[model samples]
Target: MKVLVTGSQGFIGKNLLAELKNKEFPEILEVNRKTEQSTLDKYCKEAEFVFHLAGVNRPEDQSEFMDGNYGFTSILLETLKKQKNTCPILISSSIQAELDNPYGVSKKAGEDLLFEYSEETGAKVLVYRLPNVFGKWCRPNYNSAVATFCHNVAHDLSINVNDPSVEMNLVYIDDLIGEFINALNGKENTRGDFCEVPVVHVTTLGEIVELIYSFKKSREERTIPNMSKAFTKKLYSTYLSYLPSKQFSYDLKMNVDHRGSFTEFIKTPDRGQVSVNISKPGITKGNHWHHTKNEKFLVVSGEGVIRFRRIGTEEIIEYFVSGNKLEVVDIPTGYTHNIENLGETDLVTIMWVNEYFNPEKPDTYYLEV
Candidate 1:
């Protein structure tokens, strides 16, 4: 299919073009702010489908709204008409078109013109009146509050929220792309006269800011946010994408001694915690027993022997472990256990506990194994 995409450098247009290329669509003609009129005319003549995404939403002058939105639509339609090309054209209209503001008025006028053109030429038109759309690559501190909040919080910058309770209806960019591809395949989700992206998340400005702040703090706290909620999962992913390239890696506080270092890697409220432990050669650790806490240890380097014994038993059980053959040793409650590095090199082990350790009541007792 010979597809023509206007505003090819725009946030939505960039995402759509990437997916089209992934799908291996043949012959894509791009039109942007720098595209020449003659090139657009040639593209209009050969385009089998058109994605009209260029528009002005944040113009410095109010008069530019009509000129950029409605006026551009008129020019594109006229060019297509001159070539007698009546391909399926999908226009990205805003839900604000239902209002009477300058930008809304211009968008509504463009929609009206597309409807008229479709009627006159018997062409297929898919008009999507989208709500607040957000995702990765969206410009920060602009029209999208979600993008601004994510960027600001990730960078430790302050955000101004005039109305904490203001509710916003957001459609993820991936979801919008999915619906657009559906329209390309003639399977649009139409509601009355306009098309809609099926998935929408309704949230308040306060909630969005709170979640973004939590995401920022997750690194320092070695915590993982709850991702069961679809909106939170998508929002967290978007927040990480805005992190500075130089700040991609963060340092963890490692507890070090002659026996080596132990570092907490990640902690979750419901999934317990993971830690990395390193012991020097001939060093023994964990000569203790837990009342209720249990753990699993996997030696990833060197050689070690884990010794275990029931609190009331005198017999000691030993499990020899080595990096050559990976294995996990379970530490059951009420059993005194200790791991001793037997190799010449340091022993590294990954440990997973059922719960986060509490210093107030550790439930640990000293014992010999």
Candidate 2:
């Protein structure tokens, strides 16, 4: 079905478009702020579903709020009303509309305009009043307190609230998207009905902040090497007792072994090795090569192409490896390579490396093949 999404560049709009794409919905016309009225009308004419989301939620001036929120929606509704075939238009209103803020007042005006237009012209208008939404890809400066808390927690900063007791409902962005999808897929016979949509109260602000604190604390605990004196002493005693020879050197050594054949060993250290594995069929791994570290690969299973290009040169090298005929191939530093798994099963490889990986100072460079 053809769907037209307005304000497709905004935070919520971008996410909603992604969700629609993932669902394999056909023909999603993204209408951004730069979209002209002519262009919008053209798409709306062909669309079976129109999601009117173009509007400024927060404005510095109250007058600007009217122009952005109410004005933009009114124009869009009028355009749809002018169409020969009336399509189901879903308007994303805000819970703020029920409140006394200027932003809320403008949204309420838009909502009223939609209902009036719907009644006069037999337009299928479904209004969704959303609460505070939170999830991945959320921005902090926006009207989402949960997102602000998440960002603060991610940076290991303590969250301080002006009113910790204030209870605010939180709904996941994906859940909000689900509600939109359900409304979109509902039968046409239920179009004109003024449905009191369900509001999902996922969590309060206090609970959300506490959850962030707990997650941050857990992450911090994992980083402490020597947890306690008693634990360290016990570990040392066990290590000494396990040694078979008395002539063993005081030099500490660590060895790590990775399970599975698909992992390509890049560097082998005393304790462990760095590895890379491509699980998707017909998908390529790194397109870049490292200059400072040597990499060894053993294809455990499946089949794929290992393509490499030398640094500063356009020369390309290709290798086809499979699980049964597994061999350790050393990719020297200064060469860029990516592995493409060609088999149905996971194309696994074990990489062994001596140094820890760092993206910023990466000795790796990419070249187009």
Best candidate, lDDT = 1
Give a tens-digit lDDT track for model 2, residues 12-86.
788789999999997998898899888988987888988887778656877998998899887787777677657
- Local accuracy of candidate 1 as per-residue lDDT tens digits, 12-117: 9999999899999988999999999999999999999999999997999999999999999999999999999999999999999999999999999999999999
lDDT of each: 0.94, 0.68
The top-ranked prediction according to TM-score is 1
Which ten-residue region of model 1 has the weakest summed lDDT? 136-145
Candidate 2 lDDT (Cα, 0 to 1): 0.68
* C-alpha TM-score for every candidate: 0.92, 0.58
- How far in Å is the alpha carbon of 250 misplaced in model 2? 28
